[model samples]
Target: MSRPNLRVNAPLLGARRSGPARLLAAAGLAAAAGLALPGPVAQADTASVRCSVPDLVEAIGRANGTPGADTIRLAPKCTYTLVTADPGSPANGLPAITGDLTIDGNGATITRPASAPAFRILFVAETGDLTLNRTTVSGGRATDCPLFPGEGVCGGGIYNLGRLTVNRSRVVHNSAVTTVDNLFAEGGGIDSDGTAATVNDSEISHNTAAYSGSTPSSAEGGGLANDGPLTLNRSRLTDNTVSVADNTDSFAFGAGHAAFALTTIEHSTISGNRVRAVGGTALAALATGSPLPGQATSLSMTDSTVSGNTTSAPNGVAVGGGLGTNFPVTLTRTRVVDNTATAPGGTARGGGIHIGRTGDLTLKDSTVRHNTAHAPGGTARGGGMSSATGGTVRTDRSHIRKNTAEAPDGGTAQGGGVFNAVGSTTLTRSSITDNRAVEGGGIFKESGTVTLNDTTVRGNRGNNCAPPGSVPGCTG
Candidate 1:
């Protein structure tokens, strides 16, 4: 896991096996059987990559040509630059994984040349299984492609439609950009569709997503755009961005987009992620599901810290500088600090959390502080959180302080702390203090039922809220 300070490089979880041991494991097996497997002694042959294979592409072909559950044990500390003559249907480029396979990179780096065609480093086809061990994938660039029926291009670093797991790996400095109108760009580092890509002891950082298209399309998920299930443990996502574009109908999302997916993150850190759209979210787990009673989507974050993230729709509506979800979201033992959601010419809301779907949002033992929602030409509300109709907002043993919601150009600004509009809100054993807004500085109730128990509502900048003995603590 990354340290609280962002300057250090966290190492992998466990030590890697030595090269000598791996090189000799196959030799020992062959000698014990009184049979000789003639190949170079530098790499093991427990799987498919032969010692005589010239390059990575051939090795991939050889491995794919073989049957199920193969492992391509690569030479130690090698760098394979994948290239292709025809990238669309490439004879080169990492072959699409056909079945279950493990690439024992042994600390290798698989990348592409600078002058190569815009291509991703890896693609996991449907029903294929890929496990990357101790490797690095970088320098990928995905341009406008017809992958989304002339509507979008995604997964600059990795496009996965299957199962992908990584152990002790890093995916960095990749990008996905689209210039075609009516098309969108997603997943500067990775885009997973129906792909349960799990990462352990890994880092995905420094990726970018730039899309300048028309309305009704989003340029989102600077680090990862997941349309399925994604889980992370002991990982970091930092320094990623979704650049501003002409998107008006849809908003951009950064860090990770659980737009139509389920995400679980634990012991992880998301920092320094940025987005600039007409009105979008930054560094949030966005759940865009209106399910049928039993098909709800959600995000769960435990023991995580989300800091130094910015989301702005400078000319549109901006919500959720830290998190935006339409379904159930739970934040336990989490800290969301120093984040901003700005809408300079439009509406801005929810500097920390935006609950849109009609579900319950629970925050336990969490801290939401030092966040801001600013609007220069429009209204601003909910420096800490905003819950729409049908959603139930609950906070227990939490602290929400030092937040600001302001409209600089004579626009209305209310709900500096919390905004409960047509919802049910409950605060138990929580602290709300030092929040500043134009009207309600502690909690705002447009039309809702609020219940407070053992909660502290004090030190707010405006005396807009009622005394502690009331539910839905504020009245405008």
Candidate 2:
């Protein structure tokens, strides 16, 4: 399919001049200073490139040098395999996009060969504006950043620092690994840091972010990591995995998606994502609403499904197998189900959703069910939903059922349906039933208040509520 070209006007650089006059001025200045001057600026052009890596590289270079936004059309149904990194800065397969550029991929693929050295596929600088349409990015690996060591190596497929839009694209089979200790590897598929990115009708799946250090290290966002304003519409992030060393101080977060800024998700699915950690908390699928530095974040999700996600921390804590948040969140018509959180020698909390100390969750018309949390040698709490200190959870017309919290090896299990630890919980027109736990099978209030208005809590195993009369209108 052909995409229409978008024409952009060139910016006026100080003052417009004729080509010959500008060349003469540049030559006279170079002669006076005895310094080599840059080449002439190229005009914007819509070019079609053949199925060659060199042609693609040259086309991107020309587009980057153009004054206005240039559109490069890739050869249809062709695979442009990159075997080596660009000999320029950032060490990407193609030149780093520095200006407004768009690549109209007519069902074409641009990927790195499996035997290629560790390098990202694309990088968009802070002054760039990149748009990708109908493209596939795969088989990219990012190891480290020599130029910017503090930033570490991130975004195996595409790294965006300015503005980015991806439509009808697939980002899969990419990896970002950290070989050294304390250094990090983030965003196996894409990373947009302190920028704006929108993904429409796209799929990001089968990506990995791992830390291979002998000691402790961190790995985050197997599919995507964004510390900026991000929007996802009609998209899916599935089957992504994040792994960290099974040592102390190691951490892995958000195997499917992680956002530390304001984010919006509409008609999206985050499913089948996994996380493995040993000494730090592992959040499996979605980790949004977490504050970044001094800025607080929030998430607004509608018509979304977060299911079939799993997290395991052998000697550490596992929190939120499906969704985890720390600021504020609003969910409408969403479902969190079939997620598992396991911590064999540690604590396991929130098999479905975990709200941190500063989090406030407003769930409307949503469902949390079929989730499990197991801690064989430690405490297991909240098979469905758990909130930390100073958190507030409000549910309206929601259903929480069929969840399990088990600690069979002399450990304690509490709140198979909902766990509130020094937090406030209000349920209006909601039903909590068929949950299994050793104590507080329906709802657990650990020094917190529980308010129920027209809510039903019954059919739970072990006990309906802890302390016999802790929760009003709930039977033990």
lDDT of the candidates, in the order given: 0.69, 0.81
Top-lDDT candidate index: 2
For 304-336, candidate 2 gives per-residue lDDT tens digits of 999999988887888888988776889999999
RMSD (CA, angstroms), candidate 1: 11.0
Off by over 4 Å in 2: 1-44, 145-148, 292-296
Question: Which residue window of length 10 is worst by lDDT in model 1?
Answer: 9-18
How big is the positional error of residue 129 in model 1, measured in Å on the Cα after superposition?
A: 0.8
Please give, for residues 94-151, the per-residue lDDT of candidate 1 as tens digits: 7777667789878888777778877777877665788899888887777533234345
Clashes of 1: 2
For model 1 the TM-score comes to 0.83
All-Cα superposition RMSD per candidate: 11.0, 11.1
